[model samples]
Target: MSNEQVISSVKDSYLVEKRRNQMIKGAIVLFKEKGFHRTTTREIAKESGFSIGTLYEYIRTKEDVLFLVCDAIYDQVRNRLESATDWDNPSVAKLEEIVASYFRLMDDMQEEIIIMYQEVKSLKQESREYVIKKERDMVAMLERMFTACLPETIDEQDVSLLANNIFVQGQMWGFRRWMLQKQFTLEEYIERQIHFLKQSLSTDHMQNEKTDQTP
Candidate 1:
């Protein structure tokens, strides 16, 4: 194809993907505003301004819709963390950026994040696994970044535990926005957390990790 034709094709693909995302985002808003138990496929279709028939083109059930919403969230966090972590940057700065990206994501998509955090259990076993596995993948990705940042003295076990704690604690801030908002703005809250997070991944912990690894 000619360059102009290729460009046109790419643009068309982009618009299609954008519309599909809008449908999903619309559904997330409805799911958050009305709890998942009270929500129906028709409501999601109407909220998305797509016919119920067309909505089915993307998902077969309410569970499917929930999975898609959480998937979008996980995919975004995965991409953000991948983009934020630059090996060349100082470890502390990279850590701050990673945490900052997370809070900014929460601030911008509070409803979506809150919904997934609260409603993932509403899904069936398989659906829940799909979401939870993606969550784990994201944690592993961050842990890799943390590994690069940590001193060689830090052992695998401590780093693993710390990675889990940091991710869970960050999620809590988003899940409890009603209370956390009363305490601070999204940026202020994240900065304070990052400060403590940096201190927590201390040289002493690395030494402990090293000791644990002693053969």
Candidate 2:
């Protein structure tokens, strides 16, 4: 089930989606300005252009809003990444495109990403676990892509690690932008990363080729 479906008190699916979209848009603006702890449910209601009573109809507490925001951010990132690559015909080039697309998406949502990292700690235990599971699912998506594109010798464990590294590398741009932005443009950063990734994967590919010939 979607985050909206899980938390929203609104019984109608269409209404749940509609109201949550408004709430998310408003909550993001407030969360960016005041951080999660300082942002109040009434404020979120006001920001969302809904009455406090109407807002309550959709969510029970401020924590629900935070959960919704975090879930939406992750979903947006995952959806864009999916569109950026063709799983039916995965290739190294497609992998490169996915990385570049993810970095750009992170850059666009840096403030929200920062908010997610900082305020997710305040969520209830179950909500936090749900968010973590979503992240793992994303890493698994990357792992599948790597498995299709990489040579057989790379091994599942290596692909898994590489997939995680690529995901983290994209997030690092958002989390460490103050330092990275000063040093390199987005294109430069992507180019350097692609070079490093290819170097690592190609080394494994070549070693495997040599071993196969030697026997």
Candidate 3:
């Protein structure tokens, strides 16, 4: 389904965008503070500065708001990753840069990220599926970038796993901050992850080279 269907009752494109943004902004604050289960539609409306009736005009249910927040978070992340890197013929160094940028964005949106992981189960099946698909798209994007970086030397499976791991590592900072923050600053975390990732991928490349040389 199209993203416009995320909020269906509204027909005006501009108004739908405007109201959804307002609702998302408000719902995020509530969800972050009270958690999804405890938060009420009334509170979301109040936080968003809209009446209960107005909230319904844009979203059919509170779950819609949750989905919207998750959607926005991904949109922001993908935008940052795409804009910062040279997508065409990206090098391993460029992939590392993307990973570092992703971690920083996660740090900046830590609270929202926390809510996203903790609350995603609350979304209805269809809504959950949509979010999951968007997530897959993101992982696939990274996989493509890494595959391009290494070309014939890197195993596609290795790139796929690394891409998935990179995505999780970024989210881990948000959900595991209480522990991670005690051990490393954001810059340190970013640096170490990139280093570890580079080392791992390089090892795979070297092994691939050895196998080819042996044959």
Candidate 4:
């Protein structure tokens, strides 16, 4: 590559990785405090240690920062889930691993997850579309993870809904942490959620078998 080409590539890659993270780091603080709708680019710039002008070099608006935060949270969750889970494992096993990984992340990055939950609705039109696609992608990943655990009777829509439900419950866990922590440690809480989940969706058919046999 020419020297100018190499310089541009380095600049682009550095900006791609750095400024976005700077935005996410700044956003975590602002969104937690002022909230998504109330926060401003200048404030985000202050928190992120960049001027509003520099911030705009990477992103055009506060809404962009909002999406960056959402994307960052998902990226972290995806990494945790992928590393801690064995996708080729049986459906039930994969589900358990996914929950474990998810709970680990929620406990580890509680603040960031909390920020995403609180701020996602503030994303603007194109920005909202970007995040919605990422959200769907996350759901799809879990749906595939749900595949092995599902019985023949369950449809994909059911599995997808169940995956979305689990995601929702996990998100709520951060919000209801006072109540959850009151009852159990994070590990114990995860175990409880998994147990309850399996009981609700997983064992119904088996119980039906016993009921059918008894007659």
Candidate 5:
């Protein structure tokens, strides 16, 4: 499901990974500026410090580069989330820490996140589906963490909604920063969001408890 599956004329695995990483870095900049359709493979090659011929050796088409970039970005986000989170001991405080970490990551990778959203449609259907599946996997990770920390009385559907909301809220900081950043600093935003999530969870747990107590 990664760009490793992309056809490469190069036989050396290390060189293939190295050059593809270079391609991903260069392509993200161009994609952010020109979009996927407007950017040319030659431009990607030049930006990546490879000739067109050398670039073709590693990728069959420009779509391949886009897929690589998307895959790399998702891998980075997931790896960072894994590192920041403590799955062994789930708690509300740990969930808040994970959400803050995710928002901070979104802020740091705003350009890459924007490019992924803007250019994802240009990818082939299979590649696009793969990218979407990766996204769902991350959301599912949050859902698992939420399930572990939330009260048992909370409905499954509400837990899923909470998990999805947390995921999108992190993304909103990147895609909607023009408005959000004008209104709040990053620390202020994280504090307000974490507060909102806690309030919602507490209210839901209280309601569920009341339902159980009803004769």
Candidate 6:
């Protein structure tokens, strides 16, 4: 569902978007600190620099706030990825650039990512599904990028799986920061991951070509 379908009583499009952004920013802090189930709507309103009455003007329930937060975070990630990517030129080097950019973004958004993972289960079923679908869309974006760069001999299934692997590897830096950060700096992590991905892609393509020759 679109942000417009979030059931706001406010009619001004710009105002609705502005207020919701404020609400999302504040709600993320509270959700991270107290978690979604424990964070009260009144607290969210106050943190957002508004009153309970005004919060209700923009949302019917706290779940609406959560949905807005999740949607906003996803939008930010997707936009950053799209901007970093050069869609017109899909090459292995370009793919590596995208991977590094994505890993850096994941580092930048660590807290927000943690909040989403922790609180998304609190979202209503429909809202949860919508948020999940947004994630799938992101994976699909990576799949398209991989398909463009990888050899045709690579199975379609492997390309899809590789895309998912890249997506999760980016998030793993966030989710596993406690341990990973102890070992490698963010730059190191991104470099190593890019190296590994490039090697895997090259190895797979070579193996596929070798198999074709054998037959």
Best by TM-score: 6
Clashes of 2: 0
Reference-based lDDT, residue 34, model 4: 81
lDDT for each candidate structure: 0.73, 0.87, 0.83, 0.73, 0.89, 0.88
TM-score of candidate 6 relative to the true fold? 0.96
By lDDT, who's the top model here?
5
Runs in model 5 with CA error above 4 Å?
Answer: none
TM-score of structure candidate 2: 0.93
lDDT of 3 by residue, 52-87 (tens): 998888888888889989898888887887886786
Residue clash pairs of candidate 5: none
Flag regions of model 3 displaced more than 4 Å: 1-3
Off-target runs (Cα >4 Å) in candidate 1 are 1-16, 88-90, 203-215
Candidate 3 least-lDDT 10 residues: 1-10
Candidate 2 clashing pairs? Answer: none
Q: How much does candidate 1 score in TM-score?
A: 0.82
Over 139-177, each residue of candidate 6 has an lDDT whose tens digit, in order, gives 999898888876788788998999999999999999999
| TM-scores for candidates 1 onward, in order | 0.82, 0.93, 0.93, 0.80, 0.95, 0.96
- Kindly list the per-residue Cα lDDT of model 4 for residues 1-215, writing each as its tens digit: 11211122235755657866877888888888888878888998999888988777777667667766777777887777677667555667666877878877778778887787667777667666776777788777778777766675566777888889877767766888878778878888788888888887757667656776995
Q: Which consecutive 10 residues in model 1 have the weakest lDDT in total?
A: 1-10
- In model 4, what are the clashing residue pairs, if there are any? 91-148, 91-149
Q: Rank the candidates by TM-score, best first.
A: 6, 5, 2, 3, 1, 4
lDDT of 2 by residue, 82-183 (tens): 898797888889889888898888888888888999999999998999999999988998888888877778889899999899888988888998999999
Residue-wise lDDT of candidate 1 within 95-141, one digit each (tens)? 77887886686677777888887899988887687678888887887
The residue-level lDDT of candidate 2 at 52 comes to: 95
Off by over 4 Å in 6: none
Candidate 5, after superposition: displacement of residue 83 in Å?
Answer: 1.0
